[model samples]
Target: MFWFQEGLCCLPTFLVVWSSSTFIVNYLIALFRRDVDVVFPYISDTGASPPESCIFGLMSTITAFAGFATMFARYKYLQRLNEITGGVSPALNKAALFFAITSCVGMCFVATFQETAIRIVHDIGAFIFFLSGVVYIILQTIISHKAHPYGTSKRVCYIRTIFAVVAFLAAFPTIICAFFVKETRLHWNPEDKEYTPHLASAVSEWIVSFTFVFFFFTYIQEFKQFTLKVNTELLEFK
Candidate 1:
């Protein structure tokens, strides 16, 4: 019980580090194997092939669940605060939870369905994941700013708001630049017409991914300031 309470504060850090490493390590693997070029590639592109694909799938599955747990923890924390202060309605927190869960579901799809193998499913998943994730963070920022004395400092809210803005800004270009690319490939020549657009899209995606990590990183200290308890009662019949 002591360990559980103590370790709960590290949930945000674990999510940030694990997910960031998942992307970086996969990129390095793909590069080392010559499966992908040194140039920026879509996050999915790095994990679309053999060994890296296997690692990507497994690690990404874990990342998705970790992300969901972090979000759910935040939701529950906010709900408890609302119960005490009555600052925001339960519905707002529920909406944030809904989007966070939806984003994780999308992440699961991205993990299970490799982009090179199932482009349509992968694309759909990417769409859902980024779109829902942006909404989740935006809602979270609002709640953080509005929730009174929830141990959320103004600086934390500002940091979240900045990352939320970056995610929103990067999301549009990730989709728009992809439209400009004629084809999707792991390696691209500088001379190819699709190269620039693909690079733009890829870079934008990396920015958005980093923004998520940064936003979650902000939660670490705030989470440490509070403790949560779960109670379960079993019914007994005589």
Candidate 2:
């Protein structure tokens, strides 16, 4: 039974982990491109140092592709879940769709554009993802409390609610920090004119990073709760 339960959850977790890993790898590769100096001579002055050409660009491209694949997987997963559950809430479904679209767009843009633009869009995408995650968890909590046959105790419901709230609150500071961080720049002309979309990109990255960390911890707790519930159900059956 544990095997069956894990099999059911494994695909989604794998998709998320793979997508995230690709993204990080790509970001690291872009950080060290040799042509970075030629493209943005003034990068040093702005506190953005050029990195050695590495696998980041390739990784980033791979990440983009993986993200798109994950989006499709997520859609299919939700669709099947809806069928099993008699239908998901329209609002939650819509929100999930929004996040899926935004994240895909952001990843595509990051692959095609310069770092600054990519940073800005990525931040927006991250926020959408964070928002969607929160909504899904909340809606699930509500459904579990109201409908689950095992009967959710009031204490359990309250604890879940508090955890969700704390997770949501962490997003704000993360976003704010991302907005204020420095950005990578590229010079267009020989006049050494600087054009870096620093403020937004920096802040976005900071916020996304912080938010991801917070969500990671929150999700671990959520997973524990889910496992506990499943175990209890299985024991009762035994």
Candidate 3:
């Protein structure tokens, strides 16, 4: 039997692939072109209104869709938890759902107001996305510990716990570097033989982004039971 839930759950995977691919491809090209700041340039900078702005914009659009799908998936996951925990889902599950939704909205806002046209709104959206993402991961780590109605394996939960911790740790520094780092200027020293900026927020930002996306790997176990409902009508979500 076909399962809409399985498809829905996989939306995050699609998000990971599409968004990552767009950045990786553009960043590689940008590296050779070196037209942008490279390190300081936000991901949205890849979509600056010129030759490849359209390309990056396309990626942002894809990310927004992925974020929307992820929000829906989180809602469904929370509902599943409610069923599993005897109609009393953990508070964390519901809270995570809300944060996930906020992150989705942030993604859409960033895409709609790309930095070139509206820098402040874009910055605000990026902050929302990153901060809410950390909160969502922390909540999910708590949720994964409960004995899920879907019989998600303990092993899977442990894996999630590990990833969640790493992701949260990674995300905080990204925000710190973005906001508080006073040294944005590049530094050169023959002692270290490295020409780099004192504040390399981009490095931390990429780590946060990749780790956050990887954190979604935890949901694979939760999606198993969505396979059982043979009723097609139920799949319609009506």
Model 3 quality (TM-score): 0.75
Q: What is the lDDT of residue 152 in candidate 2?
A: 37
What are the lDDT scores of the predictions, listed in order? 0.89, 0.44, 0.65
- Among all windows of 10 consecutive residues in model 2, the one with the lowest summed lDDT is 40-49
Q: For candidate 2, report its TM-score.
A: 0.46
lDDT of 1 by residue, 1-238 (tens): 5432563677888898999999999999999999998878899998999999999999999999999989999888888788888887799999999999999999999999998888888888998999999999999988888984566788888888899999999999998988787675788998998888898999999999889989999888777766667899999998
- What's the lDDT of the predicted structure labeled candidate 3? 0.65
Expressed as tens digits, the lDDT of each residue in 1-238 for candidate 2 is 5532542243335444654655444344444543333332321112222331123334445555554444444444445445666445545655655655555555444444444434565456455555554554455456435433333356556665665566566556545544544544433343432233333333334344333333333232223222211233435553
Candidate 2 has an lDDT of: 0.44
TM-score of each: 0.93, 0.46, 0.75
Please tell me which model should have the higher TM-score, number 1 or number 3: 1
In model 1, the runs with Cα more than 4 Å from the true position are 1-7, 235-238
Candidate number with greatest lDDT: 1
Q: Please rank every candidate by lDDT, starting with the best.
A: 1, 3, 2
Q: Compose the digit string of candidate 3's lDDT tens values, residues 1-238.
A: 4442454556666777777787787666655566455554556655555556666766777877776666566666566657756543556667887888888778777767866677778778888988888788777767666554344677777777887777677676666656653322222233432223223556667777777767765554455445223445545565
